[model samples]
Target: MAIVLTVRDSSGLKLAALATGFVMASLDVTVVNVAGSAIQQQLHASLSELTWIVDGYVLVFASLLMLAGGLANRFGARAVYLAGMAVFFAASLACALAPTAGVLIAARLVQGAGAALFMPSSLSLLVFSFPDKRQRTRMLGLWSAIVATSAALGPTLGGLLVSAFSWPSIFLLNLPIGVAGILLTRRCIPPVGGRRVRLAVPGHVLWIAALAALSFALIEGPRLGWLARPVLAAYVVLGFAAAALVTRERRAEHVVMPWNLFRGAGFTGANLVGFAFNFAVYGGMFMLSLYFQHARGAGPFLAGLELLPMTIWFPLGNLVYSRIAGRIPNGVLLTVFLLVAGVASLAMAGMSTDTPYWVLAVAVAVANVGAGIISPGMTAALVEFAGVAHANVAGAVLNANRQIGTLVGVAAMSVVLGTVTDWNRGPGLSFLLLGGAYLAGAAGAWWLIARSERQARNVRR
Candidate 1:
């Protein structure tokens, strides 16, 4: 019994280290938001420049994810993880000292390249670390908990960093964490070697250009007016280019996303559910943070703190539900979680500048719990639905869907949230519109999960 306990404890510790790696990579996902103005002032960035600073990183990170995993397999996990941290640290330093917004955005893209290197490897490492079904489920749950908490807490942390130090302090903060993580990674991780394939250069170039142009168009379209000639032109060119890229990949010797992963209904269903889940969460948070500041008269730090319930309750929910995961019906669990979160979002729609703080807190807390349940459930389902060999690509596909969902949410918000902005009600009607969308996301999850379970059964047979 004591020996068993020691093994379990060691597994848990490794999990902590791995999960922290994930959180560190993800911090960049939102930390820049609160510090955007500071970077702008420090670097003398323009409005367009500031927009690219954030969007560039996201586009690179999203596009290169699958490619990074292939790199990992060709190289080794530990090497890739360490290289990523080094690149991340180097890029962060360059970003801090960058003299212009264009330069800063370029540095940030390098940073994102590092992040793409790290993100898929982190998940792959976790799946490799714990082989037991029960422990794997639990660890994945813990991992998701940390991710959700980080998103909710990032602006708060960024606010504190920016408040006390300069905007550069935010990126500088990664040095110690990266250094420590790298040391731990080298010490603890055993070297696992496999294949060494050549990088698919043409595929990389095509996809990167496609993703960059596509993300640019989506993020810029609202500000530029969707029908603007440049935006329309960009949309047209990228659309055709992407189709061509897909056709080319179908015949490539080393393809990034194999054509048939989606042939399994389980993979398809899981990806759909994953995309919608992240879409609803990220979109809701984007809207809610604005509401807290613009509608409720809160500062960035205060608004982040106001959402503290989301940070605290998510892990708690993940721990509880994951323990009972298999016993409960998968379809019922996902459906209930989404329904509860959507309903909580609807409740939040009624909040105003004068609403009780505690009421707002509880609504977000409930939403967090629902999100907590959905994340691990979705991740585990996707991995299990795909065979072990394809887990890396499965992660990539899941991430792509996640970004797609976010894009869709962003587009919808930009289009419809204008009503509130036009009325000078800033966050009021925006919250209601987002709430309705969250409900729609819940419906999507329900439908896809039903489809997923049926597919799982068919595969088993």
Candidate 2:
């Protein structure tokens, strides 16, 4: 019989260590948004620059995730997890002490690389430690709850720290957590054997180049002129790289991604939906963070308080949806919630400078209600479609795509808001654009899910 770890068991320490890392990764997603205004003022960064500051971490994290999983498989999850913590520790310190925005962005990149390394391996440790399926599910449930709480608390926690100290405190806070987590993991988790795994070098290179070039082109086009040499060159690079990535994935035996997965009904659409979901949700939150702070003249504490509804409702909505998910059609659930979220986001576009705080909060809460439902459902669909053989890498792929959505959302929002120097008008226009994108994604998801259902019925008949 496989040993089960409860709170009282020594093996529970392994769960604790893994949870700590998850908290850190999850917290950073929203925490940095609360600090956005402070960082902008302190570092004298422009809109596009600030967007990069927020997205640079996510971009690297998403890009390297698959490779990180491969590395962990080849070199053992424990070793990779420890090394990730070490890198994260050093990078956090660097971020805290960074003298300029460029330096901070560089440090954030490294921090993301570390997170990419640890995030997947942390899950690996948990699964390896808990051989019993029921026990593992319960443990994962606890871990998921902890992650949700951390993400929800990020803005409030960041606000307090930024108010009491400065923006740097957000990064500095990771230091102690990292140290404790490493110590616990080393003491609690037994070492697992490594396997031979091939790295997808070509796929990685193409994807990185394509995403980087596309973002750079979009971000710089307004300031540099769309037809400017640099902007044109970036677009050219993006097109070529994206084409090459598609070709490379199709041809490679042991690629970073499997092209065959795209053949499944709703598979590609689900991934795209994941991207759009995060683009609207996370990207919108980032935009609101700046709007609350800059245009409304709210302090960090107040801004965080204002944004609480969105964060708080996310997990609550998830919990509520969980009870109903099995009873309802996944497609109907995904489509309905996405449509609701999209419409609510569009409603937010109507907000004027004179709009009341409570009104804004209500709108954000409504949007998050949709997010909460769709988030878990999205993962379930991706995993179900990918099936068991590709199960190991399914989450990684979905998350990577979701992060890419974040990167694009932030970049797109910046492109919209960056064009308008006036803060008051920028947010409303950006919301309108994002709302439109979300609606399009919803339609796509609906069609994809319907097609998948149709195929399933045909098979059964």
Candidate 3:
């Protein structure tokens, strides 16, 4: 009994260490939304520059995640995780001390690279630490809860920090978290052995180039005009890079992406769900944060407070998922949660500047609850499909798709905001887009996931 208790306590510590990395990463994703206006005003940044500041980290993070997974497989997860945390710590300091928008954006890109390194390895470590399926699922739930809590706190905390100090305070918040994560990880998590894996360098380079071109086209198109030479060139570059990436991926001996993973219907569907989920949730969050501050004339602190009702439900939803995860089929759960989010988001599409705050809050809260549940559900589905052998690669693929969704979502919202000019119309239209993304996820879940589960059950019978 004593030995069992000791094992459980040790596992708990390992879980905490893993959660720390996610908490910092998830916090940065949302916290920057609240800090957008502040960063813009302080840096004297244009709207496009502000978008770059936000997307720069995600762009790099998304691009390198698959490579990070390969690195973990080659160099051992523990070593790679530690290295990533150290990089993140240094980059966070650079971000906080950045003197201008260009410097901040550059630092953010580096910070994203660090996050990419740690993010996939953290999951690989978690899967290693909890070998039992039931235990791992439970830990995944708790992990999601902890990370969701940080995401929930991000905007409010950023608001308070920005209100009291400055925009850089948000980046500075990561310093202590990074230090604690590194220390706890070193103390609690045991090292995992690496296998021989080929790291495809050229494939990753093409991937980065493709994403950069796409980002430049999406972000700069509004400011520079879609027909501008640079914008046109970026589109052309994006097309060429994407074609080259596909061709290389097909021919590469060592591919960054594990193309074989998508062979399972469940895996393909789960990736689709991941992409749409992030597209809607992160994009909607970005839109709402700006709407509260720029449209409703709320200060940073007030905007944070106003967002509290919407953000707080994420943890609650995670807790609810933990309770019901075993009882319900993942496919059913995913479908229902996504439908709830989609309908709620669509309901918000009619909102005007004069719409009742409570009404908007209620709808957003519902959508958020659905989103929160979808996060763990989607993760568990993908992980189960991949099994232990492919855990790291599966995690990387899901996260890369999600981050790409994030990049596109934010850029799409930027386009909406830029083109519409009217704050009221822009946010409503943004919700419309969010709703469509969620519905698309629901369709994927229902068609692919549900059918796959049925077929599997029939085979067993």
- What stretches of model 2 exceed 4 Å from their correct place? 1-15, 123-142, 187-192, 321-325, 449-461
Q: Scored by CA lDDT, what does every candidate get?
A: 0.68, 0.79, 0.89
Pull out the clashing pairs in model 3: none
What order do candidates take by lDDT, descending? 3, 2, 1
The worst-scoring run of ten residues by lDDT in candidate 2 lies at: 1-10
Ranking by TM-score: 3, 2, 1
Q: List ranges where model 1 is wrong by over 4 Å.
A: 1-9, 37-50, 294-297, 346-362, 407-429, 454-461
How well does candidate 2 match the true structure in TM-score terms? 0.89
Worst 10 residues of 3 by lDDT: 1-10
Using TM-score as the measure, the top candidate is: 3
Better of 2 and 3 by TM-score: 3
Tens digit of lDDT per residue, candidate 1, span 58-128? 66777787788778777866567678878888998887787778888899889878877877777777777
Could you say which candidate leads in lDDT? 3
- For model 3, the stretches where C-alpha displacement exceeds 4 angstroms are 1-9
